[model samples]
Every structure is written in structure tokens, then in C-alpha cells.
Target: MGIESVLSEHRTFHPDQTFVDQANVSGMAHYEKLCVAANENYEQFWADLARELIVWKKPFTQTLNDSNAPFYKWFEDGELNVSYNCLDKHLNTQPNKVAIIFEADNGDVTKVTYKELYEKVCQFSNGLKTFNLDLGDRVVIYLPMGIEAVVAMLACARIGLTHSVVFGGFSAKSIQERIKDAQARLVITADIQFRGGKTLPLQAAVDEAFNLGGCESVIGTVVLKKSKDPIELDSKKIWWHDLIKNQSTKCDPVFVNAEHPLFLLYTSGSTGTPKGVQHSSAGYLLHAMNTMRWTFDIKENDVYWCTADVGWITGHTYVVYGPLAMGATQLIYEGIPTFPHAGRFWQMIEKHQVSIFYTAPTAIRSLIKASELNKESNP
Candidate 1:
């Protein structure tokens, strides 16, 4: 039997004419036109988008390579740096534009402009060079949702090192498995994470993972000090501030092949062993950019917010890559929805004037429940 619908509604809400006029996709006719164009010549369609959206070190001759069957490649002949596409390109146009708006759980706010972010990425990239990490070397990032996490990921991409960002909430055992699987050369994490009025030890987990053994590939750990209290450090540990202090903010971008592995993200291992999924440079960026523009109707002045951790795929695409690639300002929150108050998210949306908001359905449901509770209590 066919699956039956649990709920149905005939009501429909259309967008205001003002919004439709300014939207990227606009109306159904425009979308259908694009669909037709793409369906008519799919390879050329992707090629056109790749050329328009990406700044390539070397232009691609072929769009897709399917000679290998199940394992296919895209824009294999081209070369480009993911970091450059995200930050450097934006500098010429909107250097002073706010790239990241960080909202801490305690209600503090910090903003970083494009030029500032570029310099930080460059400095961190140079600092990573001091560690003697070479091309294709994997670095694992374990940090909270903040600017440093973005900087670390971009820095790794800038220097041609593959980065795997593990969610900050993952246990030490999970961290150990990812580190071993990725064979990470270095691990970057903060001293602590403040979330929902709780101080969680991030660095301690990395250390615990090391103590668990089997992470021999990792050479050192870069710790971003988030806590006020002093923490013990060994020769293998280095403070992030110290590493980038004296470094030059002029690290050159290392352009890699289109098919070069940009980063590795692992599955939750719900069914079996967690498998690492590798994403390439050009194709992934292209898709992310396109989706950001189409789905969010992203604009230059819009403050976009994706309420997802940087460790997840949504965060990787929307919070970090997609928005930046489009030169759109984004907001990153370092707290849960119900922290401090149930209306925290709504307050932020109004405070930041976020034009586009992307979140999971579970988050919406929680907000609804919170609203109901608040009303009952007030009544």
C-alpha cells in the first residue's frame, strides 16, 4: 500500500510582491526557465555556473568525468584555492563589510569584517606552516561555534591541508576514532566551551583522546584559550594566540586541483562504523554557492543565520562556506535556543536584523513548545 499523509492543508501563502521582485529565483516561471536551460544541456549549465561563480587558478576544460563509472570527478583539470574564493575575493569589493557576527551565550557580541577575517586566516595559515604540515595533511578541528573555528578551517584550506571538524559535543572516544581514521597531523580546539551557562572542557577531551592511544599520527595540539583559569600544557600543546602572534598576515593561497580533497566529515556511526566523507574543492563550493543563492535568496546586505554547529554539514555549507562564498554577512551563535530564555532566538533575529534564517524542524518544534510554556506560565 502507498504511504498515507498524516496531515493535510489546502491553505497556501504567497510571497509579497516586494519580496518576489528582489528574490534570486523570483517566480515559478523564472525557476522553470532555469530548469529548462539546465535540462537542455546539463554539462554546459554547470560549466557556466562554475565559470561565473568561482575564481579559478586554472580554468577547467571538462565539466564531468564519468569514465571511472561509480567514482566520478568534476572540474578535475581546474585549480583554485577555496580560502581565496571565500575571503580574498571579497576584500576588493567589501573589505569593511562584516563577514561574521558572533553572538555569545552571555549576550556579548563580536563582529569581524572581511579584511579582518582574511588577515586572521592568513596569519593562522602562516602559523600552521611553522608546524611543517605539508599539502594533503589532515588537521582535526574540535571547537565551539565561534570565529576561531572558521579561521582554522579556512587556514587549513589556505595551506592545502585537509581539515576534519568534529562536533564539539562528541565524546573523547568518538574524537579518538575520527583522529585515527583521518590520521590527522594536528588537532585544534579551545580550552573550554561556554554553552547554556556551562563550561565544558574541550582541550581535556583532546588530551583524553590522546591518552586513550592510537592517535599516533597527531603531532601537536593548538588550543584556543577560552577559559580564564590556567591550564597545564606540555611540549606537544601550543596556544593558538602564541602561534599566530608573530606570524605574518600574508600567507599565499595554495591552489589545488578541482578534485583535491578540501575536508573530511564523518557519519554518526548509528548503523555501523563511522565513515569519513571527503569533499572536493571546486564542485562542493559551486554547489554550496548556488544553493545559498537559490534557497536563501541571499543578498549582499542581508544578515543570514544558520542555527547549526560548524561541525555539521549544514553548518559547513551554510554557516561557513556558502554565505562567505557569496560575500554575504552571517551570524553565528554559540549557544542553544533555550539558553538564558526561550525567546533568545527571536531576540537575536530582531537584534541582528537577520533577513534569512535557516534551521531544522526540530528547532522550530522546540520553539513552539517553549512559546506554549511561556504563555501558560504568564497566564
Candidate 2:
């Protein structure tokens, strides 16, 4: 089952003939020289990328200062806003480009262009201010994938709030633990999560976490309506639609120090205590942006898709930040792969014409197993 053994057995390979070969026309040979320079001077490599790849309000003079040992800082003296870097710079040319294509499990589809997304971010950011959220404040997002989930993250970035997005499938106690750890004052969630033809009460789960744990820091919960289920909202609960409806879409982006905490992500630990990890602003932003370009070969014309939920680090870095920073169109699905049929993933590729697709190995294996079963049945 080893990949090395399989390759040794075949002893055959073929180059990808259908590759568009854009690099051949665009300084492909010079890339090798750049690679050599990077290998020789990594500091200069990062510094050059920081300067050219992203916009900084106050550029850093120093590329890196590893004097602090394992905790190194890059572009330490710089100032920038993640929201501005991802949205503002692309407005002129890519205003109408589809930034996010959302497909629900129930066959409903929605698209948000760059211009519209920017406006929505601004509106929700202003709405966040209405909640009296200060800079560096923590906002816990418990919504499923869609425009609102995407907007919640960007809105927090726009206002310098630290958002912690809890995965939709987490248990009530798990959500309580993260909310308690972050001491987040605001909770953003949806009425329901639709997956595998089942309705999970995402907002109800948040309510249970709050009711049981009673985190005193929580001021109110913002709820997005994905289902028409009857619900009662206490004074502490707010409808996301109504909250942002009257808000203006003209909030200015907040610029913070390069090392300012962008967000906190909580992950399970074998020791049973969930660990909360924080990423710095400038370093993390540039890392995601540069890696998206060099690693994924993403371009303006390409349609990209990273099949991961925003609750995890992979989704946060690749699905949300990376493509957005590069102004690349991305497909976001709000369902499991085998929802309608086993061939759903392939159908999506044809439907979206996705050029660059990224997914987890578990999904790949699942597809392989399903295909083998199908072959056996047909044969």
C-alpha cells in the first residue's frame, strides 16, 4: 500500500500534457534564479515577499529578528489590516469577480462578488461596533460555512477583534470550553446547520453552552437564519439580518501592529486540555498570501476550492485568507461530499469548473473505497 512500492511496480509516468504552461511565456527560467537567491538569503526572500506581496500601512525596516529564539517575528515593525489587504486592494479591477461561491446541501446556491463582500464586511463590522466590541476583543463564531461565516471573520479583522470560530459539529460542552477559554463577549451562530440531510441546531447548541457554563463575558449572541424553525430570542440574542440591516457599509479598516494577535484557534490535545493557538498579523498574512501564489499556482482566472471547514486552521489559512488575499475565486460547500451521491465531488468540479482543488486525504481514500465498491458491483 506504500506509494513508493506502487511507483516501483508501475515504473511508468506521463507528464501532464494539458497544463496551460503559462510559466513558459512568463519568465519561467528567471524563477530558478529567484529560487537560488531564496536558498542563499532566506531573510531577503521573506523581506522581498513582504514588501511586494502585501500592503503595509507602515513597512518594516527589518526582515526578521530571531533573537527571541523559537518565537520569531517577521515584519515586526510593520502595521497593516488583514481585512484591507484582502479586500480593498482588489476593488478596482476585481470588484465584480466572484469572490465566494456558496452551495448549500439542499441545492441552494449563492455568490458574493468582491465588491459585495467588501460591503458586507463593512456593514457587519459596523454592526459589531454596535455591540461595543473593542479592539483585541474576542468574538466566537459558531456558524456553518457560507457568506455570514466568512463575513463574521472578516468583520472581526476589519475592527481589530479576535474571532474564534468553533466548528459546527462540536458538542455543547466543547463549545463551552472554547468560549470559556477565549472569554469572548460576542457569539455568532446560525439557526441551523444543514448537512447529510439532517438539521443540526447550531444556535441551540450555543444556547446550551451558554446556559450550562454561563460565561459571564457573553453580552449577546448574533444569530443568522438558515432555517425557518420557530425560535424565541431573549434580550441577549440578536438577529444577524436585523442587526446589520441598518448599518452602513462604509467602515474604515483598523490597522494594528504586525505582531498583534489576529485570532485564536482551539484544537484538541491528547492530554484532554484543548490548546488555543494564536497567529500574528503580518507574518501570518504574508505566509498565507505567498504560499497561495507559489504553492497553488492560483491566478485571477482560476477557480479554487479548499474542501475544509473554517473551524479548523487549514480552512482559516487556505479556504478563507489565502484565496481572498490573492483575489482568487473560491467555491465553498456547506455539505459533506456524499450528500446527494458519491460522485458529488466530481459534479462540483464540472459545475464550478474548479481549476485548483485542495482536500484532505481522508476524502481521497473515501472516494477510492467508494469507487472500488462501485466497480465490484458493476462487474
Best candidate, lDDT: 1
Q: Give the whole-model CA lDDT for all candidates, comma-separated.
A: 0.95, 0.89
Q: For residues 205-256, could you state the per-residue lDDT of candidate 1 as single tens digits?
A: 9989998999999999999999889787899999999999989988899999
| Minimal lDDT window, size 10, model 2 | 19-28
RMSD of 2: 2.7
Question: Which lDDT tens digits does candidate 2 get at residues 1-379?
Answer: 7555443454776436454365322344667877898899999988988999889899899888899989898888889999998899899978999999998998788999999999999999999999887889999999898878889999999889999989898988988998898999999998898897898889878888987775789998999987786777889988998899989988999999898899999986548889899988898999899889877878779999999999999999998899999999999999988777778989998999999999998998888888898899999
Error of 1 at 4 (Å): 5.9
Alpha-carbon TM-score of each model against the true structure: 0.98, 0.93
Error of 1 at 190 (Å): 0.8
Runs in model 2 with CA error above 4 Å?
A: 1-20, 24-35, 376-379
